[model samples]
Target: MGWNPFRRAPLLHVANDVGSGPVVVFIHGIASSSITWTNVIPLLAPGHRCITIDLLGFGGSPAPLDAQYTLPEHVAALARTIRSLRLREPFVLVGHSMGGLIAPRYAARHPGGCGGSCS
Candidate 1:
């Protein structure tokens, strides 16, 4: 799949979605990408819909030098993506490190969205 980054947002965030079953979303730390779940996804893919996100300033996502990487901003971007995905069934969110820190706060703010958390 070839993509044109030229016309894309400077801080283009990405989410790799795969498989089909109960949803399980993974958010990696500031230092990682969706690749972080490469090992674990295969094990769980058969039974879960895995969606891993690349937060701002990390991974496949952009890290605009001018962008302010605040926790709230990151959370908001995540919330927007989740809403855009329109996942009707509540999902299990698993975040690592900084991502781990964001998960709980996100779950609390969007209580109706995240079914549970495994950080």
Candidate 2:
């Protein structure tokens, strides 16, 4: 799909596009942002288009001034990002640390559309 920008309520950040191929979205750990994957993007760039994003309240992304970082909130933001990106085709999702939990929840909510192979 072409590059498109989107934002969900309570989340304030733009998901940037890098490279081109099958989409690979990375969800960072708690307290971290998309930049956390800077070191690894190059390695994956050759095979897939990687999209790293800052979750609400972290990195360049904006967080609710009075919002608490809860699992549900994080998952909601993630779902919106995926839909907005229009990744109708099944894409590989890589999550790290706390992302491990959040990613699975997202996959579960979306069913066969997403698959999680966590460590």
| Candidate 2 lDDT by residue in tens digits, 1-119 | 32123434454365556787887888888878887798989998888888887786788876665556677777777776666676646777788888888888888887755323221
The segments of candidate 1 whose C-alpha lies over 4 angstroms from its true place after superposition are 1-12, 114-119
Task: Provide the lowest-lDDT 10-residue window in model 2.
Answer: 1-10
Q: What is candidate 1's lDDT per residue for 35-88, written digit by digit as tens?
A: 888898889988889998898777777666555677766776677667767787
TM-score of each: 0.80, 0.79
lDDT leader:
1
Candidate 2 off by > 4 Å: 1-8, 112-119
Model 2 scores a TM of: 0.79
User: Which lDDT values do the candidates have, in the order given?
Assistant: 0.75, 0.72
| Cα error, candidate 2, residue 104 (Å) | 0.5
Report how far off residue 44 is in candidate 2 (Å).
1.0
Cα deviation at 37, candidate 1, in Å, is 0.7
